[model samples]
Target: MYLYGASGHGKVIAEIAEELNISITGFIDGNADIESILDYRVIANNADGLEGKAVISIGSNKIRKLIALRDNQFDYVKLISKKANVSKRAIVEEGTVVMMGATVNSDVQIGKHCIINTNASVDHDCMIEDYVHISPNVGLAGNVEVGEGTHIGIGACVIQGIKIGKWCTIGAGSVIIKDIPDYAVVVGNPGKVIKYNEIQKLSQ
Candidate 1:
């Protein structure tokens, strides 16, 4: 399989794949100067277009990951770390990576290009949408639904059945007890929205 992006996150993804005994083709980062970071060679801009599987392997939820999939028809690829414990009944879609020590319980449905970082625990029946990033040591209770492009910061916790909306950012160590709206920036204990995501508007 081919891995996209040669940044620090890409290196981690590469390492995880190696540990899992998956065949890695190479990386495709926009920055072409990345020669041999993590002892992996970067192929270049437009990824080699090889006739094989590929993973986004990115960690930046701030920049929407769907952008990388535009017009590309590579089949979805799901990767679970060898050290992670994922229930066989759980449905993890392509372009998703479950990092080391992460535990995904039964009935969990994780969407494309989502990152479940190291030591994160996702309870049973949770729904995580596309491009969502669950940071290191995060925890989500049962039945929680994380919307597209949402970012759960490191050490954050979300109560059961809470609906975190699209592109929302939950700050580190925040405890989310209520539903969060799309594009909201939330932080602190009992997490509350601090600001709206103005970056999308600025880009438009």
Candidate 2:
């Protein structure tokens, strides 16, 4: 297996790969300055002649998507940490990474290229869409639904039955008790919309 992006996120993914007994061929990154990471040879992201499965170790949902597009020729693989408690009933898609100590309960459907970060708990029957980032230590009650490209920040809590819309960001440490709309940036106990995602406009 080959790991992409030889940064901090890559290091964690490498550790997870080690725990899974997955042999890593090397690391790849767009940055030319990094020659080696954790004693593994770091080559240019576009370097050729390497084959086999690859994982995108980037933390940012946007950047990960960009990098995945750049390396679309390679077969993307999922990275689930051995330490994570993922139920057999859950469905995790390709290119997603479930970090160590994360708990994914029964009937959870996590989409492609997501980051279920360390210690995050996603309760039963939750639906997480593509390119979402459930940040470290976040909590989602049963049946909660997160839309595509949404970012649930670190330590955030989402109540059961709440539907967060596409491209929204639930700020760090916030408590979500209500539904959030598309392109909204929300924070605080009730998780109000502080601002709309202006980038969504440009994309359209």
What are the Cα lDDT values of the candidates?
0.84, 0.90
Off by over 4 Å in 2: 47-49, 200-204
Backbone clashes in each candidate structure, one number apiece? 2, 0
lDDT of 2 at 135: 95
- The Cα RMSD in angstroms, rounded to one decimal, for candidate 2 relative to the true structure is 1.6
- The alpha-carbon lDDT assigned to residue 63 of candidate 2 equals 77
Number of residue pairs clashing in candidate 1, backbone atoms closer than 3 angstroms, sequence gap of 3 or more or interchain: 2
Q: Write the per-residue lDDT of candidate 2 for residues 1-204, one digit (tens) a residue.
A: 888889999999999999999998889888988999988988885747666799888777777777777668788889899899999999999999999999999999999999999999999999999889999999999999999889999999999999999889899999999999988999998778899987755243
What lDDT does candidate 1 reach at residue 160? 96
Look at candidate 1 and tell me the lDDT of residue 165: 91
Against the true structure, what is every candidate's RMSD? Answer: 2.0, 1.6
